[model samples]
Target: MQDEPTPIELTKAVADFLRSDITPLITGHQAFKLRVAVNILDLVTRQLTQEEGSDASEVERLRALLGMDGSVTELNRALAERIAKGEVDLATPGLAEHLWATTMDKLAVDQPSYASYRRELSRGE
Candidate 1:
């Protein structure tokens, strides 16, 4: 029987993808998007690896870093909703792509004008 992959392996795979594949595809404002996504993923992975029990403090820290003011419960609920809606993709060889897609989707949804702004920005208009 084959052994299941460890969490570290999965996280590493995602990190590798972000550094090796996704980073090169980003340009202009999308570069910022990618950077934010990578940062979030790194935080989540760190919490998962280093902490036991629920990582509410880590989530709260992330929320604060993102300029969100919310309880850990609220942040977790939002993450769960995004995951349920297929906004976050966690099934790739690396979770990084899913994280990036989800972050972009959330940003677009939260700020309806963001996509247009990014498009214009990318065009250097």
Candidate 2:
């Protein structure tokens, strides 16, 4: 539905330019600030690239687990309420796997380099 240089690509370009070009021209506090900005941009790019598929998977899992249809938010809320009421727990079918997959997707956007994520990722290989 869109053209080349998609939002994620453009975001990565900006982050790359800031990291490779502008960062070297700055110093001390400004450099640190720029690094943080670039990091945020990179995170945004990752989220833009991954959010759709991750959300789809989450919705599918929630639908199957809840045995009903609704928006992702609604399904998640239902799941939360079930868990709170002791109707669902880690022992519930697919619950742990769904939670782990969802958390991994979030970490892929928030902190891909996190040690626990890295370790878990390695185990899948």
Candidate 3:
């Protein structure tokens, strides 16, 4: 890994700079596009910071729920196949909790500001 300012820090700084300084001088369609760019940068920063931990947690949950081991994508495909065959359902222990946790993690990265996401976070759920 490199030293000093990490990728997450650099990306976040860029987003903050655009949102604070460059945003004020733009108008109309270009301003809207600039906002989109800043939002994308913000999203990238979140993913850069959170993706590894979230993915590891998801993979662990998948392994325990499925009783097998594989890459996260492979494990997810196995889970889908089992569900499709009626082998696993909401009644399965830990299934609902795992799914909910995964969804919350995704929303945390993708839309932490979303109303329901915010509400769930407030509830410590």
Candidate 4:
């Protein structure tokens, strides 16, 4: 009897399928999917930065973008909550600056809210 594929192999196969076939099949949905993906990516990018040190201006800016009128602590708590709830997924490509910036540009027109938030956070205000 043939052995079944391992979990890792299965995951890789699924990823291959998504990129090679499934994604192309839904080209019409690319714009919308890209927007959602970028939004989630931006949120994770900001969260990763917080680990380096406290960026007060960034915290305030994220709060404004999220429409949360609260102190930095409250904002952090809310972000943590959102992450825990699966409202944000951090596994997308380009966790670093360059590629992520490109992805943001590609998707920004459709994801204005994310773009706005990224602008605000980057401004250090």
The TM-scores, one per candidate, come to 0.38, 0.93, 0.92, 0.28
Error of 4 at 117 (Å): 25
Candidate 1, residues 1-125: lDDT per residue as tens digits? 65769776787688779978989988999899888787666666665564543344445444643346676567657756766888655452334533444444444334435666477446541
Which ten-residue region of model 2 has the weakest summed lDDT?
1-10
Q: Which stretches of candidate 3 lie over 4 Å from their true place?
A: none
Question: What global local distance difference test value does model 1 have?
Answer: 0.59
The residue-by-residue lDDT of candidate 3 on 1-125, one tens digit each, is: 66979999899899999999999999999999999999899889999999999999999999999999999899989999999999999999999999889999999889999999888888874
Candidate 2 residues lying further than 4 Å off, grouped into runs, are none
lDDT of all the models against the reference?
0.59, 0.94, 0.93, 0.52
Clashing pairs in 4: none
Tens-place lDDT digits, model 2, residues 37-113: 99999999999999999999999999999999998899999999999999999989999999999999999999999
Q: What is the lDDT of residue 119 in candidate 4?
A: 81
The candidate that wins on lDDT is: 2
Model 2 residue 4 CA deviation (Å) reads 3.7
